[model samples]
Target chain A: MAERCAIVGIGQTHHTARRDDVSIAGLLREAALRALDDAGLDWPDVDAVVIGKAPDMFEGVMMPELYLADALGAVGKPMLRVHTAGSVGGSTAIVAASLIQAGIHERVLTVAFEKQSESNAMWALTVKTPLQAAVVAGAGGYFAPLVRGYMQRSGAPEDTGIRVAVKDRANALKNPYAHIRDPNLTFDAIAGSPMLWDPIRFHETCPSSDGACAMVLTSERAIPRPKLAPAWVHSMAMRSEPTQFAGQEKINPVSGQMCAKEVYSKAGITDPRREIDAAEIYVPFSWFEPMWMENLGFAEVGQGWKMTYEGATALDGDLPVNCSGGVLSSNPIGASGMLRFAEAAMQVRGQAGEHQVDGAKIALGHAYGGGSQFFSMWIVGSARP
Target chain B: MADEAKPVTNIKTPMRLEYRYSAGVATSRFLRGIGQGKILGQRCPSCRKVYVPPRGSCPRCAVPTVEEVELSDEGTITTFAIVRVPSENIDVPLPFASVHVLLDGCDIPFFSVVQECPVDQIRIGMRVQAVWVPKEELTSTLQSIRYFKPTGEPDVPFEKLKEFL
Candidate 1:
């Protein structure tokens, strides 16, 4: 059996389209320092550092972690780098937590980031396969058809996407560090926004941001600190699948379902939708909110949009989702998943300033990347499991 | 300490990977624009977000930036890098300027080549104009704007371009 690991600290950079003020090293340092500060420990307290991100090509840098090692204070310590496409951020965090869970390290710092300003994501993601001769365009192009497919199959109304956009932006308003905090935004504005991928609108998509997210994971013995309450790691799990395969369900992906199942089981959860008080989900596109709802067992596959339609995910709803605005508000591709993970910890620790789910005791953080091939999830609670 | 005194034999493996990409249709248009003496951007009808090297959809709004807007040949340098050494795959000249320029009238700024000046002279918030190539050399990519040169105007105050940071 694996050892128990709990998250004692978390940090993230103010996400934006461009972080021109700092170099890649400078960005990582900013997040690491914050995590160290939150843990009430210095760089010397960290046993190891794990860096993860989407693709190196996005930043025009090759294996950037090698150059960033010293800046992250990992000069003489063991370091590992992870890449699992879009879900890389969450997978990276799980790997660092595993080190503590395995009794290898008492405190591990895991960080993930993306500098999209360095290169156009549409260009980097537009890979030309030899036999595939489709001018299908960027990431939005590839996912649009699938999103359309979900709408048609689920009979979800066109306004469902608008609701998600408004919901996430409103949640972003509470997060002071969130990018593009527009208090004047409304459902009308989101619905009236230009439609990029037919059913998908402008506000429904995630921004190409520059950001870094980090956390300090510690073993059971390392905890029991006096400064602040720590969010105990109840369960953590990850799953992956190939990019494409015949007859595979991309919208309600099986990998995501499996990841959640494993986590709920490990954490002794029976009814996730009710048992979990809050959730921070990765919704790069607004439509993903409902699609993931069904995949995560929040509702039946076709009935996922019903959950959003009834406003069940609102701040005052039964299960508030994306209370920190989520990726729809700020997305640094690599750091997006870690942001979900950290946001969940923030809730359990009573650190969520404005978006706090009132008296919340349990929550979930989820992230998925690529053509929905990768998945990482965790369950955190105020009391130790 | 005792293990340090013993002779050790180890094996090493050499591994390498390379990413080769083509300038697609949109990139071709931008590069073609660079080849010529013009700058181009695509406006999203859905959200009105103008994308440099104009592509299909805006990542934020999920709307196709369809309107091809011809921008002024001038802008400001937000940040830049003086390429002293490049990787094996690089085919450009050394000491070249890779600068992000805020295209005229556009909300978001983009990267462009800086030329017709010394590498040491470039500074953030510097007002510079695009130096275009002959019309015959035009392509449909960002390369259309050959590079930015010194505008001879004073540098914009730090507070002025703080948002670009």
Candidate 2:
């Protein structure tokens, strides 16, 4: 049987469009050192390192873990690299937790980062490849059609995405590390933004950011020495499906459904809406929050967007979502998933600073990548599992 | 019914792409060295292993490879592949040897074309040397080394070459 694992340390960089002050190595060290400091430990205390990012091409670095090993104190220690597209951050954390859970290591440090300033995110993601159809309009153009499909299927109003944009951006005001913090942002500002893709406004999209997130996971024995109350791992799960197939459901993917089912089952959660105190979900385009809600079983199909309209997902709502701004506010691509996971842990530990969800005990962290196919999620709680 | 039962067809789409990739600090130095007809490699201070195409940090030691080491042009061929099938991008003639040469004083092998020798005679552990283009034609590109030719020296021992392969 696997040993119990708990998150003892969490740290993130102050996300921004351009972190020109530091090189790629310096950027990663900023986050890793913070995590080690938070754990009250040094590089010597880490047994292994697992790192993740969106794509090597994004930073113009091929297998950056090779170059970042020293910055992370991974010299002479086992280091594993993970790249499952957007969900890589959460997957990297899961891999670290697995090491502790397998009794292979007492402590494992996991990190995910993206230096988008080093290269262009749009061109890197949409670079044309041999034999593939030419759909090189970047992520917003590609997903806008599917968003339209979701609206048609659910008959949802036109302002759902805008509402999500406003809510998440407002939440970002409380988060100092968020990349896009416009204190004067309003619902009309979002609605009035230019339409980048039909039915998708420019303000509703996530900004390209350069940042990193790191977490120090340890065996249950290390919990007593933690600086703050530990966020216990209730359950962890991942799921993937092929990129495309005829008649496949893209709006509400079966892979996301299956992944949520596995995580909820492992965590002994039946009613997710009631059981999950807060959620830090991947909502890069704003509308994905509600779409994922339906896919993750938080709400019935066609009704997820209503939660936003009724303010059920606000900071003071019954189920607060993206309380630390979320990807909509600060999306560092590769680190976006771990940021979600870290925010959820912060909520449970009451260490989220100004954005802390009041009295949050149990929370969900969700991330999806690669055309909504790849999924990784974990549930954390204040109390031990 | 016949129309629906017909076999599916493939769509052919050609794409023209452009990108300006950054070589970063370590690689920029290596590229500059190639322009000067000098081959450079980085040595890991902790492990002492040298890396061709010098990276900013070493993968094994996880430390910066700031120490520069000049590599000898003469080396041993650790392994190779004989290419026969052709593609639009394949410039070498059919049945030519694409070789992995472990340059003398360097720990890792780098890929290069092996010319001036028959593909059948290009065996592993064979001694070879880099062939550079005309001095005036030299650029920062790896293409500066046109190919590698047999050094006509004694074959390196398999025991010494096994780790590289």
Candidate 3:
């Protein structure tokens, strides 16, 4: 049997398009130090370190973990670097938790960061390869068709995507660390925005942000008595499939569904929509909220859009999703997923500050990457199981 | 401190990488066929699904696809997006239809641009045929198909192509 793990502390940087004042090392250290401070611990207290990021192309820096090890207090200790496209953050956290759950380490530190201002993500993603057509512009170009397919199959209203953007932006105002905080964001503002990829409008897209997120996971035996509760790791799961295959389901990938099913089963969740009090899911494009709502088994097929239209995903709704403003408000590619995971832990720990869900005892963190083929999710709760 | 003596927060470092990419045996054959005004696909022996611009092996079955199959230039647009944003890679004019066309006899959709039609008019299940470059200018590259154009055929029902989407 695996030992229990608890998230004792979580920290994140103030996300923005540019963090010009700090180098990559400095940016990561800021978040790591905050997490260490929140945990009431020092650098030497951590037994191991784990770091994650999207790709070297996003920042034009290869093998950054080797140099960042020292900055993250990994000297003479085990250090690991995780790369799963955009899901690396969630995967990294899971790896770090495994060290504690396996009883190998007393405490571990995990960090994820993306300095997108150093390079262009669009060009990095659309790099031309031999014998392959370069018709896809960026992530949006590749996913827009799938979104169109989802709209057609579900008969969702044209403004459904815009409504998601409006809600997330409104929620961003409450999150101090959110990158894009708009005080006057309206459905008209999002709907009137120029369409970038037909159905995906400008406001509906996630901004390229430079940020970092860090967390400290410790074994149950090493848990510190802090002011706020520690979020106990209830269940974690990851699943992956080929990026493209004949008859593959891209709109709602099976990998996401299977990953969610495994996680819910382990957590003993029969009805996730009711059991999970809060959720922080990766939604780089606004529409992914509903798309993932169905993939995560929170709604029926072709009816996920109804949750968004009915305000069931709002902050005060039954299951508040992305109360930390989500990817649409602050997307530091590599760190985006970990932000979701950390926000979920925050909700369960009652440390979410302004965006805290009232009496949120259970929370879900979800992320998908690489054409929705890669998925990593976790369930966190206030009480240890 | 004087303004001129302030620290430099940003620097310009432009870099470029160049490498030769070798197309595998299966992809080379497809590229060579397209140069001769032909669209070639390969069939997975196990699943029997034909893949356009074959990737040398079937992703699901993880087996080499040896059998070659010829596909029709015309196909149905399973899904599409009208790109209005400018990209450094694409040279087409702003606001063009980028479609995923499920070609005849092929199991998967081939991504390509559709031209010679209004962006607004492009819809799912629309029939389209590839427009190759001049014969003398053909090359062993997907760019040989300048773009796909409308064939004016009746649109395929969405139910028939939903699986490809």
Q: Considering every candidate listed, which one attains the maximal lDDT? A: 3
- Model 3 interface Cα RMSD in Å: 1.1
lDDT-based ranking: 3, 2, 1
lDDT scores of the candidates, listed in order: 0.79, 0.84, 0.93
- DockQ class, candidate 1: incorrect
- The candidates' DockQ values read 0.02, 0.01, 0.78
Off by over 4 Å in 2: A130-133, B1-165
Candidate 1 lDDT tens digits, A1-385 = 7777888888889988888788778888888888888888888888999999998878767898889888999989999999998888888988998898889999999999988877767756764442122223456655664676577568899899889889999989999878869987798888887665445567888889998988998998887372668888899999987654323466688889999999999999999999999999999999999999999999997899998889999888898999999999999999999999899989989889899999888999999988787899999999988
**lDDT of candidate 2 over B9-115, digit per residue (tens):** 43333344476667778887887788788888898888788888786777655678799999998999865655443323335666566666789988777667789
C-alpha lDDT of residue A77 in model 3: 97
Model 3: which docking level applies?
medium
Q: What total of clashing residue pairs does each candidate reach?
A: 26, 0, 0
